[model samples]
Each structure stands twice: as structure tokens, then as C-alpha cells.
Target: MEHPSDRPAGSHEARDLTRTLMRTEFRERRSVTTELAATTVRRPPRSTREIENSLRRRLGLGRLGERLDPTPWLWGWLGPLVVTALAAVMRLVDLNHPTRLIFDETYYVKQAFSLLTLGYEGDWPAEDDDENDAINSRFADGDYSDLVSEADYVVHPQVGKWMIAVGLRLFGADNGAGWRFSAAIVGALSVLLLARTARRLFGSAALGTVAGLLLAIDGVHLTESRTSLLDVFLMFWVLVGFWCVLRDRDASRARLAHRTAPIRAAEESRAFHAAADAAARPAEPDRPAEPDRPAEPERRGRGVGVRWWLVGAGVALGLACGVKWSGIYAVAVFGVLAFAWDLSARRAIGERRWFTTSVVRGGIPAFVALVPTAALTYVASWASWFAHPGAYRRQWAADLRAAGEPVPRPWLPDWLNSWWDYHLAMWDFHNGLRSEHSYEAHPITWILQLRPTSFYWPENEPPPEACGAARCAEAITNLGNPVIWWLAVPALGVLLHTAIKGRDWRAWAILAGYAAMYLPWFAYAHRTVFSFYSVAFVPYVVLCLTFVVGWATGLLRPPPHTDGWLAAGPAASSRRGGWRTDEPTRLARFLTDDGSVRPTPTAWAILLAVVALAVVAAAFWWPLWSAQPVSYDFWRAHMWLPSWI
Candidate 1:
């Protein structure tokens, strides 16, 4: 400023000139400087850092610069562990108290024990005979000698039973703890998975922990965890698949950034060189020459490829299917989600013909990655049934051939034919299950926890020492916490609006998962369904609710400074200063905020209140969830609605 060249080397003016010169040099020789900057840049642009950080976050690796500081990641895992421990205690405590099969446990528990003893499920004697009760008692007493060998015509797939079989094999299938052990363990682990998944989705460890806490205390999840039910396992695998797909999304974006960065650098370098060459030469009036054209940058091959996380999703989806056929809906939905993500990523990178390129290049690879892996994994889940000739319908093809009946698909192997016929029969059973029951609920009612299924209710039970009344009731009801489930209704509405209007990828992902698990049931409205089935999508419900809570608590927004501006300092102030003061902040604001200041106390207070209410509701309903002895009057007080009765 005071004859800048005359300023001292360390003066502010000299430093400014140095910075400008360095920036110009780097910009001009972009290709040559790109490798140097990538290797040595002390601080990269926010967008670049975000792309790289997203990949690391998905892999459960914290920031690259924070490799030496384990506190952030250490606390991340520790929080989930603490929440999972609480979940485990809630699910595993007094697991053997009931000492009897409850509701659908009458079907799955026995089938699991049979799967452990025989290679497949075995039929129990008719319910009208006393032998059935005797078999139940003997099985409970760890005696299996009287069991029949005939194969059972089970309606569901075998993965869930196999999961139950693991516990039975470990604990001798004599106690409720033995049959329900796997469900309890998987249920607790689901809390862990959901916490970590929410952390990545929302970029907040506190929000993730809150989500885990809610799922841990929700009565429906608690009861399903305590009981041997397929829905819990289905929930676990579906959540796992959802988590995998999210990771794949992060990894794909990071990969695309890395692959395209070089092309950008090359183009910038050619442009700078061409401009310099033109400026250095003087034009001659007599002989005017054409200006030099910048050489085109070499094209890089298609950068995106099949992701391993997608493969993991396919496997998880397959396992989900192995637990229940309803999982196919998720597989179909997520397959489309994967393709859409690829298309959006390509379009974002300014690629021409992105739609065609994504479909031709990314879509085919995704299909190959997901479908084959899922199909193979699903087929592998039936290994026990396929290996055991005593399984039901194992001889259908041979019998048809013996009877001179036309063999459907005669070219197929006998085992495959039999497997196909078995699947058809199972499909028929599912579609034909219109029999009515007291606890049966429509899919519409499931979101509101209406008509919760009664898993256990003891008859002629005397009052225990804890009960003040003469008559007492012991029951397990698959109800949900009213505060959390009811709140999810409005939260979901907000999520839909945000997803559509703002084009929020996170909202869309959460909505896709919710729709996959819930909307498919609408098509089967005639079939008998229960409120407990909603457990399969409970994580999404919690996610939606947590997202709203995050916004309300200002966790999703930058804290305003005392001067009524964002605390993001000069950079964010300059960019956002143009926005009117009353205008709503966008979710993308997180990308620019410094994230230095902690969220205000009000945000923490709101989160604490939500958690506290959820815990209180869980405790008030624990007697019903755990089938504990309570006075008839006390039980009646806990039923908040007539439908709950």
C-alpha cells in the first residue's frame, strides 16, 4: 500500500501480495499443483472436505485430521454401547418369568426347537389332544424324546427360526430365556446399529443416542425383543440393509469426487496456459492469426463402480427375506433407491447425458451387485431345508413324476422344482390368511400403535405379594410409547415435505425405508396383521422424530451470536449475510458452519425432556411389557385407550 515493493518482507502488504501470487501460480498451473495440494494442503475447501469426510464417517472412521484424537470416535461408540446395555437389560431381565410360550411364540419357539432337533420344522400333535400340552411341557422341561418326525408345513421362511435355533442349541430349549435369547440379543444390537446409523445420517452423536434410547424404551420393541417373534429379526436385518445402503452412498460420492478432480484440474491448466500465450503475443494488423484453442483434457473412464456396501445391503436384504417374505418389498424399493442415487450423483457432477450414463453404467452394475448377492444369500438360508429330504414338499417333484402328472418346468432340477412348489404353497397361505382375531389391526392403525397384540395373559392367577388386590393379572402387551409413536405422525409429515420441497437426501432415504416397510402392508389389508408389525420400521419412525427434534432444538442449525448473526464467523457471515433476517435457514447451512460452539442449553433441555418422558412411559408400561404380576385395577389404569384393552 505504501509502495508495496518497499514494504518489509514480513509486513502485512507483502504477505498479501505473496498469497495472491501463490494463488495465481496454483491457479495457472492447476494440473501440476493439484497433486501437491491434494497431498499437502493444510486446509481444503469445505466441499472437498465434506466429500472426503462423508466417506470416513460412513466407515466409522472419524476425520482424517483427527486420527490422533480418539475422543470423538471413542465417545461415539461408548454412547451406543451404554444405550445397548440398557436395551439388553430391559429385554433380558426376567426373560424366564413367564415360563410359557406367548402368542406367536407357540408357533416360532416350537418350530425353532424342532429345527434344532430335526433338520427342519416338525409338526406338533393336534391342539385338541392332551399330547400337545404334554409335548409343550416336556419341551419346556428339556425332554425331546417324544417328538414326532413328520415335517411341518410352515408358512414363513427359515432364517428367523435358524436364529432362534442358535439360542435353543446354546440353552437346551428348556426355558423362555433359551428360546427368546436370540431375539433379545438381536434387539439390543439393533439399538446399537440404529444409534450409529442415526449418527451418520444426522451428523450428531447426541441425536443418534436419543434415537437409541427411544427404541430401547418403546414398549412394542421391548416386548418383541423379549418374545420369540420374527418381526424383531426382520427389523434387525432391514435396519442393517438400510445402514449399508447409506454407507454405499457416502462411498460412491467420495469416489466420484476423487475420480473427477483430475479432469477439472487438467481443464483449468489448459485454459490458463492458452490465455497466457494469447496475452504474451501481440497481434499484427497485416497478418491476423486465429487465437489458440485450449486443448481438451483427456477423458477419464467411467469412475463410479459397484460398491461393497451395496453388496452388503444385498446380503442383509437377503437375510431379511430369509426371515420373512415381506423383506422382498425392501429389496425392490432399495434397488430403485440405489439407481436414483447414482443418477443424482452423476447429474451433480455436471456430467452430460447423466441419466443415460447412470442407467447404462451405474444401474446395471448396481443390479448385478444387489440381485445376485441377495438371491444367492437367500438360497443359502435354506441350506438345512434343502439338505434334509424329510422337509415338507421335499418329494413333490418325485411324486409328480411317479404319478405321471405333468411336471411344471421339467428341465429344472427336482430340488428346485420342489422348492418352487413349496414357495407357491407358502404364497397361497399368506394370501389366504383372512381369519379374524381380536388383536388383528389394519395397516392404517399400525402407525398409531392401535390394537396391540396381547402376547401373554395368565388365567386364574392369584395375587402376588406385590399386588395389593386379591386378583392379579400377568400379561405381555406389544404396545408402544404414546409420546414417541404419536409424535412420529407429525414428524413424518414434516419429513415428506422436506424431502419433496428441499430435496433432502436424508429425508428421502428415511421416507423410502418407512414406505418400504409400511406401505406394502396396505396391499395386503385383507390379511390378518398386528400393530407389532410396525416394529420392522420403528427405526425410521425414530429417525423422523429425531430429525424434527433436532430442528426444534436447533441442533440442525447454527447458533446465533449475540449480534444476531451466525457464529460461523467471517466466511459464513459473508455468504449468508445476503439472506433476509427472517428467512428460514437451510439444512445445507451445516456445510459452512464452523461447528465450534456447542448447541445452546435449550436444545439439550428439549432432548432430555423427550428422553425422560420416554423412559417414564416405558417404566409405567413395564408391568404389561414384561408380563409381571399386577393388580387388576392397576392393569386397567395402564390401558390409556379402549383399543389398548
Candidate 2:
């Protein structure tokens, strides 16, 4: 997992990027001698050649590389596949065990069936119905007969419910498996996506696999997968957008390196000739005029070609916003991050107009690709609501116009105006949603697992015969794996240190995602929120811990494959320059000639112990995650903290 900023580390990649293209003549010239007339031949003077090399180094050519990730594609994909398969099994096995609507599933799953039946969210059976002993008792038995004809004033967007509707359509809505199939499928796929993304970000398949493994075993992720809810879908799309952004960075940088290659070669050629001419000018008065300086074609109005990856990211994040409004935070943060990445890339390539060029070449294209694409896709997600005017708030514009009232944003069509109205209403509902609940938790305590939301427990029902104990507890709790979650708190500290002190972009990227998912809730701390919402950032937490663990264990560094001088790390340039990972930029410190950064025995032991403990924690918490029936004493034993109960 090489962190070589591709900013040459006085390493092989640097030598190949610069020296192979232009430095060979400066360092490897030979003077050929002929004995025919006692003639003497000499090479160009040293001072001029040395100056050119100095300029090239100062230009930061050695630090940038064309290739980004060096991992073999096979391992990159295979590891994620294996981890995804494991996650699928865990999510799918006995998924219907609880066989009841739990937590928010009671709202979303039934809403999904409502979408299927009415082409819009419809009200459930009335409160006074004789059969409505519990809210969904009849609906649980597939008796969806009492659905009200009116649209229910649904708070969230339709995209997530549409996803649940896919499952209900496929497996029939009569059972738990049907309600949850899409969530389980999407959740497992998120594991696959995270692993592949980690491989690209860290340049190591092993580290990526470790990230996937942690997410697969997380109690919150596992429980959410086995239930139908919106957040899991929201998490999946945000991850998809994050992965796309990483690809866009690589693609743009690779292009920058290519466009600048010819410029570097031209400059080096000019420098070599000018030096030779100075040495010869004193000896011969007759010399042809120095040719006019060649024009730099690429530098003038440098065009940033179509950024398809940025467009893809916008679309993916738009889908996320379609699931939940909280997704807007990622859209905003990522837009700025993309611009910053472009600014850094241009500066790395020695553009004199780095700032202005970034605006014209990178920033403008980025905004165009991301903003409009995201906005259009977000609006497109409402296609169904547009088709069915009976949907909640779908006819507000029409109703207002018919009553002789002026519509807000009347320039837009009626459907769009109505969508705007619906959004306003949703915003109002979210702002004032302060109704208290037992499961509400503060964002500050989320890192410590200080409070966990209970999704399911047979509060008033008798112990089923299958429990095999007089006092058994069956539950589905949205808690975290204690070993992993607690350790991640310290891991976050490590990430913050690396991001601020070492300027590791990967660390900053992870922190950005973590902040996007977890921090915004603090603004609404007075409102009803649950620990389960933390599932949205579980992937980032896993990456943070995996990144720190891999670094400390030396698993993040790639082994040496070249001679000692260039074998250390990325070009020595990255250390003096502004970017790249901390130790790799300093030339693989403490490196063996043949290999570097091998994990010490003690480091290996600690890593092994951590993995083993996490596995044990997963096993101990599986009953709660999966809603398996356990003896009351067994359930009590797993609650290490009072807040868990």
C-alpha cells in the first residue's frame, strides 16, 4: 500500500518520470575519441547541466507520477468479493427471524407497501379499527385492506421506499424476508464497494479487505441490513459517490502528468543546448542565431476535458439526497474537496497560473459537472410523484392556482412548484421534530456507544417455545461492536493528527466523510435522533481504524523492488514539497536494502489480538444483532454498559 505521493521520493517512480524523459543526457554523456589525427573530444560542461536538473527538481517534477494505485486488479477485486460474500451470508441467514416490524421498519416497510398499492404513500389502517390491536397487526398478517385512500403526508423522499418496494415486488409482501431483502442486498454490496474504494485510496488490497471485514461484523450495520430502513440505502449511495471522487482525482492527475511531459522534455532540451552554446560561444564567433523559443501549446488556455467521473459522483450523491436530506452535507463538502484536489494537482505540475488555471481548468468544470448533475438527478428521483398527482403535496400548485392564489416560483411548471412546496414542508417537519423518545441520543456520546437504540424486543409477549428457557430475551439492538467502536475513538485522534501535522490527504478524506455523516446531527441535538443513525458513517470509522492500524503495523508500506537509492519511498521531493504521506515522503526510513517497513513481531501480535477480539465481540453480539432468542442471563451478560440495555 504505497503512499508515495507520486511526488518523486528520490525513488524509481521519480527517476522514471523525470530522468528517463530528460536527465539521461545530463548524467550519462560520453566523449568518443578517434585516433586517426590525435583528435580530442569532450562532453558538455557540468555547471549548465546541474542547473537544469536543479530547476527540474525545484519544479516538483519528481514528486508527481502518472500511475496512482499499484495494486494488482485481481487481488483488489477478489478480496472485496470474498468479504462481500461473507456479509451477504450474515445479512441473509435467518433474516426473517424477528418476523415483525422493528423500530423505523414499522414506518418504512409499511410505507413501501403503500407505495406499491397506491403509487404514493397512503395512510395505514385507522386507529379505531377493531383489528388494529397493535398499529400494524393486520398489516403484519398481509391484510393491507384498510389502507386510507388519501395520501399520508410522508416526511422522507420516495427513493428509499421505492427500494423497499423492489423487495416487496420480488418476494411478495407477506413476510419479513420480503420487507428486508433489498436492504440486506444493498448493505452487503456496500461492503464490497468500501473494500474496492479502500484499495484505491490506500493502494493496498489487504488494507481494503480489513476495512470490509470490520464493517461486515459491525452490530449496527448487521442489524440495519436485516431490517428495512432508509439510512442503509443512504449510506450506500454516499459511499458510491466517495469512491467516484477518488477515481476522478486519479484520472485528472494522470492527465496532468501526461500533458506536462512534453513541456518538461522541451525545457530540458533547451537548457542543455543553451549551456553548450555558452561554452562554445567564446571559441567561435560564427554561430547561427539561437532559434526562437518554442511556444507552449498546452499551457495556453489549458482545457480540462470532460470529467465523467465527477458527473458520476454527482449522480450518485443525488441519489443519496433522494434518500435523505442529510446527504446534502456530503455534496457540499465533496464539491470543495474536488476543487482543492485540482488546485493541488495543477500546482504539482508546475503551472505558473496554478490558482487561476485551477479555476478555469478544474474548478469551473467541477462545479458544472457536480452541481447541475446532482440537482437534475435529485429532481429526477421524483419521477413517480410527478406521474401520480395524488402523492403527498403533488398537487399544491394546482390547488393554489384553482383557488385564485399566486403560486410561489410560478415561472416553473406546476409539478416542480409542488415539489418545492413539499420540500419546504419536509424542511419544516425536520426542523421541529423535537418529540422525545427513549432511544434519543446525543452526537457526543455516539463515539463511545454511550446509548444504543433498541429496534426490537418482545416487551409484552411470552417467551416462545423455541427460546428453550423460562426467561428468554429475544432482541434486535442497534448497537456497535464494543471492541471496534471504542478503538475507533482513538483511531480518530490518530487520523486528526496525521491530517493536520503530516498533511495526509487520505486521512483528511476519511475525516471529511466521518464528519459529513456524524457531525451534522449535533445541530439538531434537541430533536429526536438515535444511535442507529451512526450506521451512515460506519464505513468511515472502519477505514480510520484500518488506516492507523495498517500504518502502525507497517502493513501500509510497500516492499522495496529496486536498488537502495530509489528503493526507499516516493521521490525525496515530496518531503521538502507540500504533499504525500509522512514517512514515505522521507524515503522509507529504517529500510532494509531489499525490503522496507516490515511489521515488527510486537506490532504483528497487537494486530492479531485486535482482530481476534473483534471477532469474539461479533459472536457475543450476534444474538442482539440478529434478534436470536437467548436466555435472559445470556442477554444480560453481553451488556457491558448500562446504556446498552
Candidate 3:
């Protein structure tokens, strides 16, 4: 905090030691020059922000940015929007081509229509052994006369079905595209959300657009987008929660800094004056018993300011759980993550009692904001089920009392007791399911993409469509891009290392998604699980790959806490330029780096190669992913692994 001032020019030491100091300084500068001749240059430690600015200015980054994109605010948003439009076009085009349900669309989309017609899901009649295809064809034509009014015993909640019902209402269930319009819209929005979230995490528009591109081309995402499935909505809401938590972190930190500024200034001034007074004292013990130095002001706050983002996260996560029970994992991880962030912010601002303070002030409020809100939101998702008494198990408690059976939760009202019983039944169905499936994959192989589910495969039908050859394969397979998914394997490992070694927040943020979406599936390995479930966490896989790409592009060459990254990092969330007027930003820092850091050319080449491979893979597999009729031989060739078949 204090620096030794230059001695008076006429002082004895100034005259005697000046030559020696000059010689030492010359030797240090020469040694620094010699080090610069080699690959790495160690930066001399300095006590102010100006050191970094001076370094960037010397490296030609400060002025170059002024010349190109004098203000990058517009481009940051424009870039992700452009990529999101690409995703929208891909998802929305030809959404009605097949005209029939693919895989679980038979169950979900029909249930959505049933919800629209009746107050709850109604079952379709199964009068004949071989009537499924005939029924699907009839149903696609809007002849739901066979749809029964009885409540169907569905496992998942009603939120996803309600989403599909929106599209069906708008476009009419008779039109085929209406079945999937909701999915297509949510899917495209997921890409935009992922791009925007990545931009917030990494602070670069180019990186955000790259994340969007990867997700857009990813096979499972594209297929799921065009199909009326539940996982994409689950993914979207979880991402919403994740983004909200990030916003909460920034908001809380900014407020903490604002509150503690005076305290920090007092500490710095006290430190500087103390050092000067000590230097001026005579070199003797108990010299005049100098006035007792003042202690630094208390930096601890009553609490971090209002974190409305926690409320947003609560609602988003609740909606996610409304889609699938698996979303509960995010609810857990994000709650602790947000509390930890508050604690970290307090400590960063020099709070000596951060842990206790966070628990009393920050943690309790965050829990109220996130957990209870999500629970209530999830409970509210079943409102329609409660309102419709004919819904499955809606009168379980009343029946049990009439039949003289065990009355579970007797203290609750009969309807709530029935709802609990219904949820228990759903849980039992999910927990005990072990039916064998052709495309089931363990969690280990999800990242590897070894077994992809075939949602539609008409090649082995009674009379397969002919291609240029005797047979053809038109299929919709839920697979990810081989390059990005496979590439994330190593990137995930590196993120683990970085989180441990560098204590980076970005890695922890991403790993939390993997922990929720991917790891919990291992608990259900014995159940009939499809590889398609990996779609819930696919955004994080793209983010993992992008982390390495960030390194390659030199966006992360300097510690993100420094001006190198934060200069533009805050601006990602900041409305216009949130940078303090004197704050410096440099684009060349992303192209090249200061002495201690340099652009990794080899890593950049590898990233470019990865992008090319993904492009090629997308081209080769587009027909199959889109269910276009391709020659049987071509489809077989696209199946790189026999297990994929």
C-alpha cells in the first residue's frame, strides 16, 4: 500500500547509493530483455491496475481495438442472434414432413391433444393387436373419436405436455407441424440461451456464437428439436436457472463492492500512513512510544444486497422440475452454488466473518428464494390435475377410506392425499422400470455417443422405400456430433483440473450441469434408459469444448479476474458499456497476449480442425438426422459403429 519515496537529491544516501541502484536496475532490465528473447516472459509484480494497462498498451492491444469495432456492444448481441436464427431455420423447416409420430411423440403429443380436449390426458383405444400404425395415421388426420375420456396413467408431469398443447392450439392438431412447433421453438431458444450464457461466462461474442453453432449442429439436439419430446424443455429451463444464478453472482458482487468501498479505502490509507510513520521513526525499541496506530475499518456487511436473480432461478428450476423429476438435481446444485458465490464475494471484499455472515444473511435468503419457490412452482404445475377429479388417482384417499383400507396422510385433505398417492405411483413406475430396449446406453457411453436411439427407422418396414438401390434407410437417430461430444471428453477432464488447480468459477458452473444431468443417470443404469436422455446436458458438453477453444483463441490467456478478460466480461451482462470510463479493454489481448501470456497457435489449429470435422460430420449425417430417404448402403456407412445400428 505504501512505496518508499525517492530520497532527497542532496542526501548522503541518495548520493552514495544512486550509482549502485542504477547498476542494479540496469542488470534487472537486461535480464528481462534476455528473458523476452525466449518463449515466456515473467511479469514483475506491481501494486496497481496501471501495470496491466501499461503492459497491454506496450503490446499494441489498446489502440488496435479502437481502430476495429470501436464499440463491440452491438456485435456481441448481433452475433448470437445470427446463430440463433440459423438454429431456428434448421428446427422449424420441414417439421411436418413425417406426418406421423416418431418414437415417444406417439405418447406425448397425443397426450397434449388429450389435455386440450379433456381436462386431463385421455387414452386412445387399443382394440386390435396390430392397430398402432393405423391409429397413428388416423390420429395424424385429426380423427380422435377413438380417444377415450378416461385418465391415462402417465409418469411425467403435465408441464411439457402443456407446452405442446400451446402449439396444437395455435396451429390446430390436424396439422402435423403443430405437434412439434413448441419443441422447435424451445429448441432454438435453448441455443440462444446457451450462446448468451456462454458469452456471460467467457465474455466474448465469438465464443458465444461458437457455442451456439455447436449446439445447433449437434445431431441429438437437432432431432429432438424437431420432435415433440420433453428433454429439450427440461434443458431449456435448467439453462434458464443457470443463467439466473450467474446474474445473481454479478449483482451480489457489485453491490458488495459498492458497500465495502469506504472500508477498503480506509484500510489502504491506514496502511500507507502507518508504513510512512514507521519509516520515519528512529531505529530504537520503545522510541517515544508512538501513538497507537488505528485499526482498519470493519469490512463485513449486514448482508449482500437483494438478489432477485435467486427468485428468477427458483421459478426457472421449478419449471424445469415441472418437465422432469431429474431437474431436481439442478435445484440442489444451484442452491449451494449460489450460497457459495455469496460467501466468496464476501471474502473477496475482505469480510473476516464471511461464513457465518453468509449463512445467517445470504444463505437463508437464497434458500427461501430458490428452494421453496421451486417446490411451489412444481406443485402448481399439477393444478389442472387437481382441478380435474377424473384424473388418475385423483380420489385415492376417499376411495381408501370407503374401502376400509390404509388411509395414507390422513391429516391432509382427501384430494391432496390422492395427489401424493399418484406421485408415489409415478415414482414407483420410474424407479422400477427395467424393460430391455434396443438403444439403451449407460451413462459412461453417453459422452462417447456409442449407442444412439433410433426414433424413426423405416428401412425394415413391411415394404421399405426404394432408393437408387433395392432398399433405403430413412431414420431419425438421436446422436450428437462425434467431434464435439467426443472432444468434450478431454475438455471435461481439463476443466476438472482447472477447477482444482486454478479455482476457476466457470469450470464449476459447467461441471454443476454435468453433475446434475449426467451423473444422476448412473443411479438408474439398471433401468431402461435411452442415450437420448443425454440431450438434457448437451449444452454443458458444448461449453466444455468451448473452454478449450477459449484457451486457443487467447480469450482466457490472462486470469479472468484481471483486466484482460473482465474488461469485456462484465460488459456481456452490462447493458451498454458498463466499464468505468477509465477501464481499459483490448481485442488484441484475444489475438495476442502480454509478455507473460501468448496466443497458443497449436491449440487454435486444433480448434479449427475440430470445427471442420463437425461440419463434415453434419453434412454426412444430415439426411439420416432429418429422416431423408438415403440409400441403405449410405445409411449403413454413416453408422460408424455397429452398436449405433
Candidate 4:
């Protein structure tokens, strides 16, 4: 190469030889750098914040803007209160009409009056006996003094009668207002509860108001509220239990979030320091110190403890059972629901053994919190019966002991034995009831509201002052809003689809509530169940319908890719040559378009139309729902189906 360079400076061979040497040196240096990088230990970026953000998103707490704020107390109570006031007016107005015992009121009202006076349900004469009318007349005239002292073998629990006793104490148990007063108040309060529950469940106050409004005006709910019936009380307690469970879900998630925050922050700080040191000392062998981080918290084991809200739910469900045995179904359903929710929560937080941990650790605490509390509350509801030694079955253990017969559960106390015997007898009575009545409907038809029970229907009278027709009718039929009830049939189907496909927790919870309240009736199809029993689950039906309406109207969430339409202003509309977008928006804008401001047209129209239709339907059926007098032709006109007749 030196000889070639001396011969010619610009020779190709000489230049090539020089380039080869330079390339060899570059290759050696590159190989050394690659080997050093391969031997070095690189620390990954910290993921604590990322993991926490993911968990928050999974728990639906990430979007704080979508949630009602701390002052929700003011807005929350305002809408529900208005709806409850409407319910109160509907239930309390002309409450004492017909001035007679209707349907099962013959049993419950009389028993309530007896409980108020005798601290127990007293016996009543058989229907065939002439004294039945005399006892009823005395009860009607505010005279409860001559009631028989022997304990009545009632089939239901004593708590509902206790509630009725409250009304009797306040209003003097003679009038319908006195007997139905507490039911009315509870029914109205149910509206408040349902509204608030919906608000929390759907994260929208308007939807909650809609749900409450529907419940307030539904004829079946109104009829049950205005009657001295146990179903309304049962419904109230079940709803309270459901609401409490929802509260627990939120509170538990919040607790988990609170517990994990500091751990995440510490991990992030260590990651930042490690990263900074590595960057500053690139020439030296960069060694990241093993951070003195705290042990990773168990995601499922000790994050969220057994919640107090669950205990509240248990107490509420127990009260439901105290009202009626049917309420136990809610306990069973919601117990499973709470556990399932725990599983979902753990899984969402990236727990490895979510199912096993949820069952083994979470299940135990939840059971201890909910089941035992419910059992204790149920037992406590029997306090009045426990106190009244002369009540029915209260002497069963004493009689058995005196007769030298072995008492059932001899290890238990006398009161416990007596209570168990009473429960056995009650269960037997419920299972064996084969009584027939004209209004008795199959459970299958109850959902459709095909054969509504006529709570009150005075005999038609023909007179000059009678309703302006040849024959007059005044009746209170426990019918539902045709639009709402009929619509719920399909809405429930939609809920089932979403629950399975989307695994939406809300849909599953609501479906569980409906199944608990409804599906059990199939087992007792042979028994005389009435359509009025559907009242207990009507709030859920309305909720289902409201959910569907919200989705359809884009109030709950916008349809996929339709957010563009929401963002599109009048200018965009003009640019698109006035091409309309969403149907709801188009219809709403067509009906009430004001050029100056943007409006949630679709949501407003759907809500207003549904509410208006409900109001009109209620008005059309008001005479029948409230037992108000109407002409024969007018009453017949309201019979939309032959089954309704």
C-alpha cells in the first residue's frame, strides 16, 4: 500500500486500501459497544401509576366528570322529592273511598287492629258465620274492644301487621285512610328510594326522576299503596336492600382505591430516582439500586374489607322477609350478586387468583356481614311475638313438655322452639293453600298484567245522579301502564342479551332482582297467586324500560360513532348540505328547534314523550285505578283486552 501511494496519490487501489482499514476499526468498536449493551442490566419503567389508573377505569371511578358531585345531596333529593310528592298525592288523595274491606284487607286490616289492641293477631269468625259481618262493622265503626282474645293462626309474618298497626295508632283503624296510611307513606318513600337508587345505578339524575315518575303513577303500585296490603311493604324493603347493596359496591371500590394510592406513589418515586441516576452516569457501569419498596399488597385478600353497607343490606332484606316470606328470594339472589361483584372487582384489578381468593377470603367476610346480620334481624322482627306469651304457637313447647312429649330442638329455649313451630305451621299453610277466587291469576299471566285483580268495584247503580249512563261502575283495578309494562317484556330481553354479551354488571344485577321477585312464582303456579303480586317487582320493570329508553335516546351513552353528530353544530349541518344525523336528534330538532342554542334534542323528546304518554294513560285509566265512578260505556271502553274484563 505504501509503494502504491508513492506511485500515484489518486490511484483506486490506494484509496480502497485506506477505506478498508477505517472500516475494520469501526467494526471493532461497534462489536465492543454491542457486547457491553448485552451484558448491562436495564430497568423497566415503573407501572404502579399505570396499574392504578387501569384499576380505577375498571371500577368506573376514573371518569369523575360523569359522576354527581358532593352536593348531589341537594340535586339528588330535589328530583326524587318532587316525584315522591306526586306519589303521595296519588296515594293519599281520597284514600278512604269505598269505605269497606276489599280483597285480603278483610284478613290483614282486622289482624292489624287486633295486634294494636291485643299485641297479637286475634281470631275472627269464619266467613259463613253471621258474626263476620258484625265484627267487620264494629271494625268499620272504630270499635276494636270486643275482639276475641284467642290467638289467630295467621299464615304471614307479624312485621307487616306491625306496620299496619302504626297506621291504626295514628289515624284510628276504622277508616280506609287509617288502614292504608302507612302503606301510602311507604309507597311514596319507595318512589324516593327508587329514584335515588336509579340515579346511583345509572349515574344520571334525569333517568332516576323518570324511573321514580313511572313508579309513582303506575296503577298497580298506586292500587297496592292505597290498599292495606303487605306486598307494598315487602316491595319497599326489597328496594332498600337493593339500594344498600349498590351503595356497598361503590364504597368497597372506593376503599380499595384509597388503600392502594400510597403504595403506588412510593413505587413511582423509586422508579423515578432509579431512572434519573441511570441517565446521569452513562459513562460508568449504571447499576440501579434494588429499591426499598414495600411488599406488594394482595389485590383480593385485604384490600376492601367487609363493608357496613352490606350489613345495612342484610338488615333491609331481613325486614323484607319479616314482611313476607317471598322476600327471602331477594336475600338469596343478592347474596350471590355481592359475591359475584367481588370476583369481578378482584379480576379487574389484575389479581392472579381472583376467583379462589374472592370465594375463600372475600366470601367469608361477605357472608359474615350479610347472612348473619339478616338472620339476626329476621329473629329480631319476632320480638313482639316473643314478648306475647299468649300469641298463637307461643305455648307449643310448654304444651309438649307438659304432655311428656319431646320438644322439637330441645337444646333451644322454649321461645325458640315455639317460634320454630310457628314457622313450620306457617310454611305448611302457605304450601297447602288451594283456595279459589275469581281474581286469582296464573303467575305466568302476571308479568303480562293480563288478569289484574279488581281491588274495589262497587255494584252498578242506575239513577239520575249516577254516572251519565244507564249503568255506572266504580272500580280500582290493579293494572299497569300498558306502554311501560308491555315495553318491559322486550326491554328485559335486551337486558338479557347485554348481560350475556357485554357482561354488564348493571344488567346482571337488575336481572337478578327481577328473577328473584318473579321466577319463584313458577314453582307455585298451582297456588292462587294474583296479578297484584307483580307490584313487588314493577319498579325493576320500570327501570328496565327506562334503561332501554335511555339507550335509545342516547341519554345514558351515545351510540357508537354518533358522537360526531352531537359535536356537529349548525355550521357543520350547513356544510353537510342539511343532511340529518341521528333520528332522535332529528325528531327532537324538528319538534322544538331553536337556532340560537344547541340542545340534547333526542334525549329531551324521548323523555318528555314517554312521560306525557304515561300521564295520559294514567288519566285514561284513572277512574278504574282510583275506584272513581264512571259510566258503563266509559268503563267498558277502558277494557283494552278481553282478559282485562
Using TM-score as the measure, which candidate wins?
1
Q: In order, what lDDT does every prediction score?
A: 0.78, 0.76, 0.76, 0.76
Q: Regarding TM-score, does 1 or 3 come out ahead? A: 1
lDDT of 3 by residue, 323-385 (tens): 999999999999988887777656554467878888988899889888999999999999999
| Deviation (Å) of 56 in candidate 4 | 2.5
TM-score, prediction 2: 0.81
Model 1, CA-based lDDT? 0.78
Residues 211-251 of candidate 4: C-alpha lDDT, one tens digit per residue: 99999989889889999999999999999999998888777
Give the Å error, residue 143, model 3: 0.3
lDDT of 4 at 133: 62
lDDT of 2 by residue, 1-645 (tens): 544445657677865656444544432222111121122113432443343343334322233432332234556777789989999999999877677677778789888898888888888755663444465766668878768768888889889999999999998887888999999999999999998888766666667777898899999899889889999999999999999888887676555655556565666566556544444442222323343354453443255588889999999999999999888898888888888877766665556787898998889999999988988899898888888878888889999999999888989888888988888999999999988888888999998888998888876644657577778888888899998999999989987877665566777789889878889999999888888899899999999988777766665543222221111232221121122333341122211111234445766676678778988999989988987878888899988888888
The TM-score between candidate 3 and the true structure equals: 0.81
- How far residue 618's Cα lies from its native spot in candidate 4, in Å, is 0.4
Off by over 4 Å in 2: 1-72, 128-135, 270-301, 461-465, 558-597
Q: What is the lDDT of candidate 4?
A: 0.76
Q: Please, what are the lDDT tens digits per residue for candidate 1 over residues 86-188?
A: 9999989988878977678878999988888898998886666466666777778878776679999999999999999899888768898898999999999
In angstroms, what RMSD does candidate 2 have relative to the true structure?
12.7
